[model samples]
Target chain A: MDARPTGFSRVTAPQFDPVVRLRDFTRSFGDNTIISGLDLDIAPGEFVILLGRSGSGKTTLLRTLAGLDPTPGQNVIVPASRAVVFQDARLLPWKKVWRNVALGLRQGDVRQRAEDALREVGLGHRLDAWPLTLSGGEAQRVALARALVREPSLLLLDEPFAALDALTRLRMHELVLSLWTRHRPAVMMVTHDVDEAIALADRVVLLDHGRIVLQERIEAPRGERGQVARALRSRLLGALGGQVLEGPSPAEIIALHAGGLA
Target chain B: MAISHRISASLGSARWLSPLLFLLAWEAGSRSGLIPERTLAAPSKVLSTLLDMAVSGELADNLWVSFLRIVIGLAIGVTVGAVLALVAGLSRQGEVAVDPLMQIKRTIPTLALTPLFIVWFGIGETPKIALIAFASIFPVYLNLYSGIRGVDLRLLEGARSFGLSCAEQILHVILPGALPSLLVGLRYSLSVAILVLVVAEQINASAGLGYLINNARDFMRTDIIVVCLMIYAVLGLAADALVRAIENRALVWRPSIVAQ
Candidate 1:
């Protein structure tokens, strides 16, 4: 690792109130248990990234945090207000772009608010455009705007940039960081790319076999990520039970890991 | 954009070519004695007959009666069908109570029940309107029910996450999603209504296009028969165009239809 300063000291204020909390939570589908006795807590304004191999209950955990899957008599506390962006944009094809962002908003200048939100996501020119007419990146941006318009206390992103090209994904990471900074909503993003997790998250978590296996805080500043990404990559891969190979970048390691399944 | 404009301009002219050619051949065939005027009245003769009937107010009177029957019957049939579809699509008990009966009714041809309807309601406007309504109900019910049932459950989950109440979800998400299918059903039902109206009016009617055709057949006036058939065809086309206009307006967000 480089000897540069890590930005850990920038977090000066104490974080007290938990935006999400789970204790002894367990979930199952018939005889197969997906999550069992998982305990976790997320504080307000924290940016947490979840990383795991496929079928490691990452989605189940995220859904549980979103309160979509309820386990009775287990302690699962989530804020009353929350928003989620899925892998697919999941926009309503029958609605215009602005109307889609304005969906379920009930009071006060809804059209103006929707327009403002779209503008924030760099989609002001597409208010009247149909969802089917948009490119995938544009559709995802509109989905982001829809999530932001609600101004929820908790924002859950389930691989929101998994479908984008490299350049677009980079732009989306910056966009997400800017939005997160402006709104200060507690964000929990699930991602497959280890670099992506290290780049955007304040804390990185690894999950395996229905349990959290490793947790690490990323202390590098945004501009100094290049100096520390290589070291973090091997650590994440080791936690995922894979050894880094020679002659390939960290992204290649992830691509090889993903390709091994097929 | 320029290429598309040129293509559409050519397509627009191509649409009129075949119909114009067919009319010319029809007129020529009748004049050449290859098709006798008595069998299939020449286009000119039909037009003249139409004009004469219009001048005498006979065409207008019959067309008005036919239009009234269709409007009333379609209104009643669509209302009943839509209500039943909503009831069934929204609940399991309603589906169990309504769907089987609808299926049985669907299997029974509306024409097969014409004689029974006449006996039950008597040979006045009641039986004729009832026949039209009975014929129209099935298409509307089947399409609307399937449309409501086929709404994406994923979208419903999204709506729930947005804190939409049950009624708002139905009004905004479910109904708009189903509008396209409902319009298709309306088109099918309108054609069925017209077909049943023709049959019903022929069975002892004082007025209507069917009555006019029956009268022309007794007198062997093929020109009048051809004229009445033309009116029915025009009415069907007009109703279809009306529904298309509504579909265009209501589904403006659909990218496939909204070309700039």
Candidate 2:
């Protein structure tokens, strides 16, 4: 429960117990030090978006948290119950959709659980569909179902919607928000899209080289409108070393969202 | 364009038109004394000889013996190849121990070992079976080994991230991922088994297609020889067709097949 006094990643809320806590984590590959002296924590049910450019060690941090890359001893801590949805959806092409969702699950009535999960993702009809037969967006939805079926305490999404079209990406954002609100697993989503980060995150943490350069808490509700979004856009663009008004606006995003519905 | 379309349409309708025409031409040439029957038997004569052999049970006996040799040889070779591939594919130490020897086997022609095999196994069913088995091993081993090695590392990473155990990973991910390649190896091994069976039966065989071919050669029964060669060709085609059927059924998840 002790939130250590880290440079810019100091968590203020003392009431919630974080499922993940990293203290002074440094990872290196031969001569290349990918990440160093990193400290971050994720509270239960909190959605944290990790924002950085390509070489800013965002993936390194996410991999370490996902346990794909081993952490040295006790500096990095994570719950045993965790699942990751990778960028490509990584569904085993041979397995049917429901089977892929129920993979490694050993509890009661695995198929029924998988069916429920697929239903939650609005993919109940694709329960027996092959992974290759799915569209990119459908495949990613299956990936989401697969992760959610595990009942993870920590959910890690590495650019799950990056490969999707704009309409599909908007739909995914809404679907993920509803799923998150329903399941309430602490989520860590890594992306370079500033608007996506602001749209989804409770707290946005920006990484420069390997350490956190800035952390912003969006006190407003999810999907802020008008002035709040424009101002937040300015701040994120400022951290990213670009002038304001470079990307799409909130009005355009809403239009895209409306187009998706139509 | 119209003429070309007409020709193609005729071809598309009658699948056996070319073979039937060839047979008719051969029959005419033999009747007109244009073709020496001793050199190449007429298609009609070959067909009659095939029927005669079939009725006397000679063809069935020889075919049964040849089929037995292939089945036994394939069983041994496919099992040994899969086991070796699994051992080498699953571990680093096993690869160091097994892969170099397999690579050496790959380069050297298995047929070149026929003389050595006869000397060791002494010109019986043992030597024939040994040669057949030896020929069958490399195809299955090489393809399956390459297949196992070529499994996408990212998929394995994803499996590990989901907490799949080592054994579970192999069963669910590695084996399924390598199945298409394994089937390719199986197809190659099956054909090799038949090819080696033909060679093995030729080694002082008492009963088999090779024995029948030898007797036909001595008597200069060119019709029987042609019949045996036709059987061999048909068997090869049948083996290929069987593998295609298996691929169609098993690889339905593949995008190309999924479309169908």
Candidate 3:
């Protein structure tokens, strides 16, 4: 056997305050630092949305949080099990829709759980159907079902709704919010859409150059989508450094958009 | 949407028409004396010879002998190849050790080893079967290795995220993902099996289609040779169709291109 080193060391850190926490994290791929000296905390059931540009290391951070890769000491304390929903809705092409949804289920009562999860995602009738026959929205719904069926302590989403059309994305957002309410699992979603971050997350963390540039808390009720969404959209655009041709104050930019200007 | 029926019908027509045209052309060319009639017998003569051979149980006995060799050789090859491919595809060290050996072995002609096989195992069923196994193993190994290793990283990560252990991930993700490619490899392996069988019979055999062809050659019975060749082609096509049927059932979740 070749004596090459493997990075699959299982470390059992103590359970401290938060369900998940990252402290003084640093990661690099051959000199290209994806995350360097980063620290964050997630309350047990807090919904945190990570916002960034395309190459802002949002996905990398989420992957690290999921224990998919090795990180520096004291970086992450991921719970026993977490589930992830990927952007591509990566369903196994040979499995049925139901099988894909119930991917993490053990034997015996797993059938019921899988069926329930499918029903929750509005894919009950697609249980026996082949995965390839599912539409993009259906596939994504199945992927969501797969993750939620695990009943994980933490849920990681990597731009999962980015591929959906506007209507589907909106519907999926509601479903996710509903799931979060029901399951109350800690969710850390990475997305490029600022409005999406504000709409879903309790706290929004803006990432730039692999470092947290800004963090803000959203103090709004979950069910009041219209008022909360509109308010949060305004706040998020400001955080993202929206354009200011006439040097409008941050408040004015929100006003200009809310008032139907440019 | 409605084009499915039309496409199926067109394919159906082509399927029968291709073989019919091939047989008609061969018969016409032979009868027209474009080739020497004795040297290249007509399709009708080959059919008659096949019938006579079947009635006398010569064809059946030869087929049984050949089929036995194919089955035993393919069984051994597939088992070994699958085990090696899985081990290599799973472990980095296994891949490093096995990949180079497979690469070198893949290029070595199966026929080139027949002489050595004869020297070691002797001119009996063992050598012929060994050659068939040698010929059949590589395609299955290459295809399976590629299929297993090429599974999407995101899906693997998703499995891991769900707290699935390595064994669960393999059962739920890797095996299913690799099924389609493995089916393709099985089909290719069957083809290789027949090809090596024919060659082995030609070199040294007292039974099977290869032996029949050899006997015809010795007796100057070109008609028998032509019939054996046709039987070989038919058997190969039938085996391929069987594998395809199995693949279609297994990969039902994989949609046609239009659906994608």
Give the candidate number with the greatest TM-score: 2
Summarize candidate 2's per-residue lDDT along A136-172 as a digit string, tens digits.
9999999999999999999999989999998799899
DockQ of 2: 0.74
What i-RMS does every model get? 1.4, 0.7, 1.5
Per-candidate total of colliding backbone pairs: 0, 0, 0
Of the candidates numbered 1 and 3, which has the greater lDDT value? 1
Cα lDDT, model 2, residue B192: 91
Give TM per candidate: 0.88, 0.92, 0.84
Over the stretch A42-121, how does candidate 3's per-residue lDDT look in tens digits?
A: 87778999998888889899988888887544446677668889899888776778877777677678788999999998
Which wins on TM-score, candidate 2 or candidate 3?
A: 2
Candidate 1: tens digits of C-alpha lDDT, residues A1-262? 1342322232445466588877777888999988787888888999999999998899999888777776566677788889988888878888899999999898899999999999999999999999988998999999999999999889999999999998788778878888998999999999887888877888998888888889988776654566566778889889999988755565453333222322
- Rank list by DockQ: 2, 3, 1
Model 2 vs truth, CA RMSD: 4.2
Best by DockQ: 2
- The per-residue C-alpha lDDT of model 2 at residue A127 equals 96
Q: What is the TM-score of chain A alone in each candidate?
A: 0.88, 0.89, 0.83
